[model samples]
Target: MRAYIVPMARSLTVALAQYVPLNGPDEVEVLRSSAAEMCSAAPGLDLIVFPEIHLCGDGDDAPDTNEWLNAAAEPLAGPRQRALCRVAADLGVWLIPGSVPELGDDGRVYNTAIVVDRRGDLVAYYRKVFPWRPHETWAPGHDFTVFDIPGIGRGGLSICYDAWFPESTRSLAWMGAEFVVNVVKTTGSDRAQERILARANAITNQVFMLSVNAAGPVGAGGSLVSDPEGTVIADLPSDEPGLAIVEIDLDDVTRVRQHGTEGLNRMWSQMLPGDPLIDLPVYSGHIDPATWRPRGQS
Candidate 1:
């Protein structure tokens, strides 16, 4: 496979806003307040990330299942979204307002993450491809999206449960994403596992990974950033609402991919015809039965 050369920045500063979301009428206000805090904390940061579903609180223990969540959803041109854009422009910083419950044109709700540039323009968006199974009601997204940050290289977006599948991060890396940002709203116990997965994805893909999680009883708040070498460079406390800032050099991604063992570039270049194990005939209704079995258990 041929490798694409993406623009690299010397160094980029990023901030993760870890905060508990408020329910009821004041939810958007609370979110904007958190954004203000983040902007105040890191005035010169290149990028700032918020938690998933920050607009409407994660409907874990809330009332009215489908109706409430769908009601909370809004179009990309809605007032709430415009407010977020305004925040980015006012702060003069790139922002990922995290994932929101978007009411699509097909009348279905999707967990969508939106990216805004410093001028408050909608740059790109990625819907959550993998929703928390059985529990989440939002529709799943089908495509992987990546976007470039003018002076900060390329970045990809994932939401909450998408981090569990290594393929999500790998696909982004394969598309020349130098950094992956995962915005999440998970319970306290699941936070550790998510962090571990974030670090693993970073090292395996040779890209920086930023996992920004929500705070409070609804969320675990273990927001963290992992470098290309899988090192946790910045971490926020689980119980409290706070901000964590870290400076990352985009060149680190190039360094690791070129120098690390069996580097990603080399591995991709060496792929044979059947190297990837995709779907089997049995699973796709091509095979009848008894064709495959456990390795040792005939």
Candidate 2:
């Protein structure tokens, strides 16, 4: 089946490096406006993925994430999520609200990526596995999740720092994911860094990797879309607020899983001795956002 995603980029365009500190009410309001813009860019969008915590700004200079996100965070069946889900269902497409601060069991929250299908039903949810710095304040996600977007093979889920881990991406691939969507709010990382990830993830798993980052101070807005063979087909400027829509063939996804003609063999599946990380268990609550399991290839 033919496939595509309208990677809606909004707010601090692609000009801000690292992270953009929320300047004022106007800057904070950009989050809500982004959703409206994504809806307008909706015509042929089969799936739309937004940036990580695109709803809330950074900590030091932005609005209170708890207040701002909680205000906007839909309670499983709340308004914000419902409105976006409505857009997906009405458009006969899939919607992935990259990341949000979801309320948890205790006085805690989860950095989560919530998914909705064409029917407006919440299919799967992925909590950020590798919580960023301040993320220590939030709840840790326990498992990796993959969701089928109707005709799409299987789509994987991860948030910002989680992109740093190969297991997070590969787990999705092993679970039958042909497309992996990595939602990021990277403020200080360079385009080169993100490029390495997209290309590596795609090349290793032989799957399409969509790296969508919030353009601002924190995420260093270098959003990218890579093919299964690990070739970067499209890249957005680090400081521009823009939307990138790409049409990708999923069949190519199968080839990348088991590298054939490509020069680069799968990176994560191979291992070596003396690599410090010797059979580490999944960290329960203190997992670092950039820590991947030593067994990405094992």
Candidate 3:
């Protein structure tokens, strides 16, 4: 008899920079410096993620969101965004500068999040779809976005309020996303509920979840990371700037989905080819048996 050995783990090192946003003309400088310092301290950091709208801070305090947007918003091609992309390239690390106030060519502002790869290329940008209503005035986005990390895994991007909608995570998972990063800046009392939703989203989707919230004056903090089994692997305190450095094994997502969450409940596997097409009237769609499982599994 011969012993067998499995291959190496596909792990990803992520740093959740839950810091207070420096909302000013030099905010981009502050971001560059902070990211450089983080890369220096933690060498080989695969990804660095910030909170939602960190560039603009908590501008909702103004008479109207547009008032703050007029002063802080920048076009996608502006120097500030380009500078942030350079930081990722220079540091040789993936970076998500959180959500920024994007001055669209249509003369409307959008709460947008951009992804910069290790090569500093602006790969993907997601405009927030489900903006916090009545409070958020920015134009809502129409589509969801996901990106790949080469040998690591695929990742999806969603903003603070998007987590409130289950369809967001489910659709991303269906698109072959191994993990979803929900950048957040929650200053309200609903953070408690948001935490639960994070774990629930991970468990139901069988994907890793990183909810990175801001801290100090702009947010209530309490950032967290949930694994494929719905276990909160890392978390930060409330109302304070902190960093949550988490290393996740993408293999765990495959393991849980294959072997079941606790070796018992395999939600995706529950739907078989012979099952009927379940109709969802709310979205005016139906769950096709041909595409019911995870992207590749189907």
State which candidate has the highest lDDT. Answer: 3
lDDT of every predicted structure (CA atoms): 0.79, 0.63, 0.88
Give candidate 2 misplaced runs (Cα > 4 Å): 1-42, 58-74, 134-136, 258-298
- Clash counts per candidate, in order, are 0, 27, 0
The residue-by-residue lDDT of candidate 2 on 1-298, one tens digit each, is: 5244423321111111123333344443443355445556655556677777665554445356555554444455555566666766665556676676676656466788988776878898888778866734566788999886554466788776777788788788767777788887766645568768788877767777888887654557778888877677777865666677677766565444334426446544354444444443664344332343222222
Better structure of 1 and 3 per lDDT: 3
lDDT of 1 by residue, 164-249 (tens): 99879987887788889999988759788888999999977778999998887678888888898888899885658888889988
Clashing pairs in 1: none
- After superposing candidate 1, which stretches have Cα over 4 Å from the reference? 1-9, 24-26, 58-61, 261-298
Q: For candidate 2, what is the TM-score?
A: 0.72
Q: Give the Å error, residue 18, model 3.
A: 0.9
